[model samples]
Structures are given as C-alpha cells and as structure tokens.
Target chain A: MDSIIEVSGITKVYQKRKTKEKIQAVDNISFQVKRGEIIGLLGPNGAGKTTTIKMICGLLKPDSGQILINGVDNEKHRLRALTHISAVLEGSRNLYWRLTVRENLEYFAGNRGVSRKNVASRVEDLLQKFRLKDKETELVNRLSRGMQQKLAIAVAMLADTEVILLDEPTLGLDIETGYEVREILKAIAKEENRTVIISSHDMDVIQDICERTIIINQGKVVTDDRIEDLLKLFEVRSYTITLGEHLNEKQEHLIKERFLDYQYESNRIQPKLSVELLKTEDIYQLFDILKLNETPVEAIDREIIQFEQVFMKIVKGETTNGVDQVKSQSV
Target chain B: MEWIKSNLNLFKANFRKETIELRRYLPNTIAMLLTVYIIFMAMFAGIHSVGAPGTVDATIQNTIVNYIFWYLTITIVNGQGYEILTEATRGTFEQLGMSPSGIWRILSARLLAQGILTAAMMIVLLYLSMLTTGQSLNVDFVTIIPIFLLTCISMFGLSFIIAGLTVIVKQIQAFLQIFQFVLAALTFVSLSRAPFLVFFPITKGVDMIRAVMVEGLTLNELGFSNFLVLTTNALVYFIIGLATYLYCERYAMKKGLLAHY
Candidate 1:
C-alpha cells in the first residue's frame, strides 16, 4: 500500500517553565501510515501520544525530523500539507461549544475550504451518518459526551480529507456508546477507505478496530506489530488440573520452577493445580510434575486469555519470552 | 483568484459566527453598552458641572472621539489576545491549525469582523451619550473615515503584537493593563505641545481623529504634512507589529505553546 503519512525520526522537547528542565515529549519516533489503514497508536498516560499527534497535525514543530503528508512536508508547506489531513483532538477542544452542531459543521467545512454550496449538503450527510440529525440544531455543549465525540468525528469527515487523526476517540464514553463509536469508525475506515490513526487507552478499540498497533512507552515505540500476531505471540494459556492426591515436596518445587503464575490447592476436597503455560507444549512438563506423585488427573479446564491481558503484559514489560528462563530451568 | 475567494469565504464564515455569538450572548452586549454609557455619562457630568455649557458640547465631542479611540485600541489589543487564549483553553487551537485556512487567515478574518462590530458599537454609544447630556456634537463620519482607517491600522498592528505576546507569555493580562495605561497617556498627550510622542502607535492618529471631529477639519484641510505624519505612524507601527507577531508565533510553535492555554 502507498504511504499517505510518513513520520520519520520526529522528536519534541518541552521545557518546564519554573525549573527550566527539558523534558523529551517525543524521542526520535518514526512510523508510516499506509493509505486506508486504521492503525492504533497505543500508550500509557503522558506517553507522548498527544505530542506526536500535535506534530503530525502541524500544531507543534518537531525538534528534529520530517513529516510528509501525501508527499508534502508539513513543516515546509503547512497549509498545503494540512489540506490532506483532518484531526479530531481529545475532549471538546476541537469543537466550538457555543455553536450548534450544524453550525459547527458548516463553519469548519467552510474553514477547510469546502465550497459554500456543498457545505450544507455535506453537513446534512454527516449529521445523518453520525446519528446526529435529530440534534443538528442543538448546541454542542448541550450534547452528551458521546454525541459530542460523534460530532467531532463528523466534522473532521466533513472536509473529506484522505487521512483522519483521532486522539482518544472513545475516552470517557459509556460502553454502549463506545461500542457504537467503534462500529462507526470501522465502517468509515472500511467503506470510505480513509486512513485513520487513533490513539486510545481502550485496548478493545485497538483489538476490535485496528489491524495494526504501535505501542509507545516513555516517549518511545516499544512494540509496533499486528494485533493478531501480538495476541498469538503472547498467548498464555492457563490450565487447571484436578489431582486425586496432594503433590509431594519435590513435585511442588518442580511446579513452582516451571510456571510463572500458578496456584496449587491441596486443602480443598478436590486438589487442583492451576498452571499458566506460556507455550502450548509446556503442558507436557506440567503433566510430568503431576505424574511424579502418581496423582490421577480427574479433570482439566483451560482459562481464556483476553487482549486486555496481552496489552497489560506487554506494557508491564513482561513479554512472552521474558519467562523463557523458567522454561530453561524445567528442562 | 481561488485563493482570494477561499480566504474571503473564511472571513465571511467567521463574521457570521461572531455575529451569532453576539446575538446569543445578549447580556454581554448589553453590559458593554452600559459600561460605555456610564463612563460617558461621568465625563459629561464632570464637564457640565464646571459651568462651561458653551465649551461643554465641544469638550464632550472631543472626549467622545478620544473615548472611541481608546476603546478601539483596548478592544483590538485584548479582543485579539483573548481570542487566542480562549481557543487554547477550549482546545480548538489544534483544530484551527489543522484547517487549510491557516492561522494568519483565521486571525485576520476574526479581527476584521471584531473591528467592524466595535466600530458600530462606538457610533451608537456616541449618539446615546450626546442625547443623554442634552448636547449635540457635529460628528462627520465621512471626515472621520480617513482618520479612522489610519488609526485602526496602527491599532491592529498593536493588536497583532499583543496576540503574539499572549502566545509566548502565559500571564499577559497584567502587562496588557499596564500597556493600556501607557497607551492612554501617549494617545491623550498634546502632539502640538510635545511633538515627539506622535511616533507611538495610535497617538498621532487619535489626535488627528479629534481634529476631524471637534474642529471639523476636512482630510484636505488637515494638510498633507500632518496627514503624512499620521500615515507614517500607522504604516511603521503596523509593519513593526506584524513583524513582532510573526516572530512570536514562530517561537510559540517551537515551544509548543499553541496547545497550551
């Protein structure tokens, strides 16, 4: 796919007003967004997501690096480069609170160089698409958070720009509204074939909507890969085995050495061993431990690991390979 | 032609938005009118009680022009500054930056719309102040137009400087207040008595405006030399103000202050 947005070695540093200490907000980060790709920009709080977004949107100048939008350098030709992109920033910052929904749309459309005659029809179309037709006359402040977010996105879409940048699109929204927004974004990305770069704390948003994700930590990209590959790589399957009798000391020691997170329950009526295996083949090692005590395996059940857990594990610096030493010791 | 059309459309759109906001916030407009009225009434009462009814009318007219001059200066300075401050606070600065219109076009459109509104409001208040004082001052807008345009150009320059400063300096209100007082003193200074003060922004232009209103000096009657001096003040300050504003904008963007309130 042709790249619509190319961000190369972009860095930004901010100075604390009082202490005069320089803080690197974005440290030599680089990524290319292909056309029509919905890529999730994931990070923890204060992880330079907003700073990166601002640089790409031309709101802030990068300390060093180049950002090209549709082959135009944003820093050199801001107005020309920015014409190809539209951003829906976090919160109500992008919206005019005092203006009605329809007014805001028309105003931004005009501001974005949309023709005078087409603004009305374009706003009408977005109003219907975002389900904001009923509240078109309502003031932006009067709309709920979810509706405001929808309107913000709708306003960005009004420009009909090729690339849309959204910072925390589903932040502070209810589950149902969040779900609705996710579906709306998915439909837009697929049907419109518009490139989208979304920064969100919600893992579900990344897992469900984005095909690929760039995870940042401490102002740096820690992992940039496909969501499916990440899930498969960090697939930690947990299994519980019911034993006829309690395990001896050697077996207990062996179980502790093999698994990173597991529970050995001996006092209950059914002695069960819950083991988290990083690799599927580790189940053989687990059965070996249980067989040492001649304990019969009555039943076994596996626990499902979710994308949220995978995200947590990755962010906490516990990559799937981090436990290979335990696996080596068992051998 | 296409570029000009797009910029004009942006200007018209911004004007419409400002008008809608003015209509929606009726109390703010009313309060602004009352504030001007009260200030004008105090000036009228002070001069009337001095027992100079003959000079009272002329004095009131002169004061009205001066008041309008001061109002335009302060409004342009603070209004443009606050527009940026408010956008930053509301987080719309990024959105504005992302638009194809650019900051220069956006600010120009907004400031032009605001200047027209302020000029209209000043005219209405001038009439109301005259009626309330039971005195009529010969006011000629045709004569005022040339002087008004020159003065407003200089004032717009000052406004650009203030807007730029507001971007770099987070707490600029205190500085703006102090600068307002300095501007008042310079603008009210007698150019004939202390001729050197005419170089300051809006100083000579306000004096010329007073001459047009109180003395009924036509643009031709004001003489080319005096007109030239006012023109120089307007052009020089305008260029200086624009340069300062552009410099401040570059620094602010480098420091990432555009996103900060």
Candidate 2:
C-alpha cells in the first residue's frame, strides 16, 4: 500500500528549565502509515508518544527530519499539510463547551475552511451516524462525556481530511462509552477508508481497530509489525515444560545459559520450566538440556499470550535479548 | 477565487460562533457592557461634583468620547487575549491552531467579529451616556464609521500581539491588566499634546476618531498627512503585529507550548 503519512527520522529534544539539561523526547524515530490503514502507536508514560503525535499534527516542530502528509512535507508546508489532516488531541477538551453540538461541528468545519452550508448535510449525517442526532442543539458541556467525545471525533471527521490522528480518544471514558468510541472508530475506518493513527494505552482498542502496532520504548521504536503476528509470535515462542523430578545443577546451568528469560518452579510439587525460544526449533535445545540429567518431561504447554501482555513485555524491554535480538525492529 | 471562498467561509464560521457565544452568554455580555457604562457614569458623576460649571458640558462630552474609545480599545485588545488564555487553559486553543486556514486567519476573523459586536455595544453605551449627560456631541456615524474601522485595524494588530504572547506564556494576565490603563492613556491623551503617539498602534486612529466624534471633523478636514499617518499606523502595525504573532507561534511550536498551558 502507498504511504499516506511518512515520518522520517524525526527527533525531538527538550531542555530542563533550571539546569538546562537536554532530554531527548524522541530519538531518531521513523514510521510510515499506509493509506487507509489504521495503526496503533503504543508507548509508556514519557515514552515520546505525545511528542510524536504533536509533531505529526504540526503543533510541534521536530528538531530534525521531516513528516510528509500525502507527500507534502509538514514542517515546510504545515498549513497545506493540515489541509489533509486533523486530530482530536484531547478528546472532550478539544470542543467548545459553550457551543452546542451542531454549532461545534459547523465551527470546526469552518476552521478547516469549509462553510457550514457546504457541510450541513455531512454534519447531519455524522450526527446521525454517531448517534448524536437527538442532541444536536444541546450544549456541549451539557452532553455526557461519551457524547462530548463523540462530538470531538465528529468534528475531526467533518474536516474531511485523509488522515485523522486521535491521541487517547477513549481516555477517561467509562467502559460502555469506550466501547462505543471503539465502534465509531471502526466504522470511520471502514466507511471512510481514511488512514488513522491512534495513540492509546488501551490494548483492546489497538488490537480491535488497528492492523499494525508500533511499540515505542525509551524514545525509540522497539517493535513495528502486525498485531496478529506479534500475538502469534509471542504465543508460539513460549513453552511450559513440567518435569517429573527437579533438575540437577548441570541441567539448571544449561537451561539458564540457553534461555536467559524463564521461570523455574522447583519449589512447587512438579518442577515446571517456562521458557520462550527465539525460534520454534530452539525447543530442541531445551530438550537436550532436559536429557542431560534424564529429567523426564511430563508435559509441555505453549503459553497463550494476549495483546496487552505482548505490549507489556515489549515495552518493559523484556524482548530485547529474546525476540528483539532475532527480529530487531528497534533502531 | 477558492482562497476567497475558503477565507470567507472561515470568517463566517468564527463570526457566527462569536455571535452565538455572545447570545448564549447573555448575562456575561450584559455585565461587560454594564461595567463600561457604570464606569462612564462614575466619571460623569465626578465631572458634575467638581467642575467649572461653565466647561461641564464640553467636559462631559469629551469624557464620553474618551470612555467610548477606551471601551472599544479594552474590549478589542484584551477580549482576544482573554480568549487565548481561556482556550489554552481549556485545551481548545490547539484545536484552533490545527485549522487549515491557519490560526492567524481565524484570530483575525474572530477579532473582527468581536470588534463589530463591541462596536454595537459601544453605540448603545454612547447613546445611554448622551442621554445621561443630556449633552449630545455628535451622532454622525458617517464620519465616525471610517475612523472607527481604521482604528479597529490598529486594535486588531495590537490584539494579535497579545494573542502571540498569551499563546506562548499563558500567564500575561498581569500585563493585560496594566495594559488597559495604557490603552486608556492612548484614548484620552490628545494628538497635539503628544504628536509621537501617532506612530503607536491604535493611538493615531483613536485621536482621529476623537477629532471626528468630538470636533465634528470630516474626512477631507482631517487632511493628507494625518490620514497618511492613520493609514500608515494601521498597515505598519498590522503587518508588524502579524509578523510578531507568527514569530511567537514558531517559537511556541519549537518549544512545544501549543499543547500545554
């Protein structure tokens, strides 16, 4: 697929107010978002996710490199780039509390240089689609948080831009509203066929709406691949082996050398060895270690991994020597 | 033609939004207008209590012109700056910055809308003040409109400067509070007494407005050099103010200030 947004080697640095110490918020990060593809940008706190989002939105200028929206360089042509993109940076806070729902739509559409008369039909369609038709004339602050959030997203959609960047679209939302937001996002992607880059800590939203996930850690892109591939990779690489007897010293040493990251449960009734292999065939090496002391393997279970766990493990730097070494998506 | 259409739409959008907000926040709107009236009344009361009874009528009329321009100046400049502060606090300012028409254009449109609304209120206040003082100077809007509009251009320029600072610092309330008095000084101080004030934003326009409203001067009577000064102040200050605003915007973006308070 052709890329709709190209962020190339972008870096952002900040200075501490008193000491003037330089902190690199984003360190040489780069990613390409395909047209009509929904991608998740996941990271921990202070992990440069907001910095990258602001850069993409043209609200913040990166110290180095370039961001191109529809082949237009954002830094050099920020306004023109904005013509092709819009964002809901703070969800409900993005709206005018004093303005009504319909007024907010018209106002934001106007901001994008589209007249209210021109977008009147589109606004009605969005209000109906987002289930906000009944509350069109209600003040934004009077609306429920879910409705406010939906209006914010509706405002973004009204811009009619190709790419929409939503930072924490579901933040501070209740479960049902969060679910509703997720559904709206899914519908937006499917119906509009627009490229969407979402930054969220909610793993479920990412897993449900995004085909690809980019995990950032310590100001670098650690893992960028398919969400399903990551789930399957993490699932297949993990194995739990139950031994009939405790492992001898040689077997323990061999297991530790072969699998740097594993759980040894000798204290339990059955000595179980939980290890993740770099490759599926590495299970043979584990078998060799088990045979050294005639350690009888009673059962071998492959541990199933959830996307949240996959995200956690990737972000915690746990995948560095294991999966990261083999795949090496990090820069 | 497309540029004209989009910008017109942009202006209409903000203009309607501002008008709707004014209507929705009717109590606050009334309070703002009343506050100016109350202040003018107090000034009128002062003129009555201690005065040369012979010059009382002229003094009241002059005070009315000064107070009217002060109202326009304060609301035109500080209103937009207050908006910047509020939007920054509420996190909506960045949304304005995200517009394709650009923040500067939106702000310019918003400032114009605000100026028009304030002008309407100022007219009502002028009539009320005249009724209260029972000393009408001149109600000639034909002469006053051109001067008021030109002065508003300079005021818009000053507003852009305030907007630039507010977006970057978000804590310029103290400066704005003190600046209102400075605007008062500009509106109250005459041209012949301080000729150099002509170069400053809004000062020339206000002096010209004072001439038109208080002295009943026509456009031709204002002459070539004075009109030149007025036109130059409007254009020069507007260009300078917009440039300063854009520069501060670039600085804010570099410092990542747009997203935070």
Q: TM-score winner among the candidates?
A: 2
Give the poorly placed runs of model 2, Cα more than 4 Å off. A241-300, A320-331
**TM-score of every candidate relative to the true structure:** 0.92, 0.93
Clashing pairs for model 2 are none
Worst 10 residues of 2 chain B by lDDT: B135-144
lDDT of 2 at B36: 85
> What DockQ results for candidate 1?
0.69
Off by over 4 Å in 1: A249-263, A276-279, A288-294, A322-331, B51-54, B134-138
The CA lDDT of each predicted structure is 0.82, 0.87
Task: Tell me the deviation in Å of residue B231 in model 1.
Answer: 3.3
Q: Write the per-residue lDDT of candidate 1 for residues A1-331, one digit (tens) a residue.
A: 8899988989998999899999988998888888888899888899899899888988889999999999999999988998899989865568999999988988887776555576777777888899999998999999999999999999888889999999999999999999999999988988899999999999888888898888777787777777887777676677888887888899999889878788988998889899887678899998887777778888999876787887677677775743431110100
Looking at candidate 1, what is the lDDT of residue A168? 92
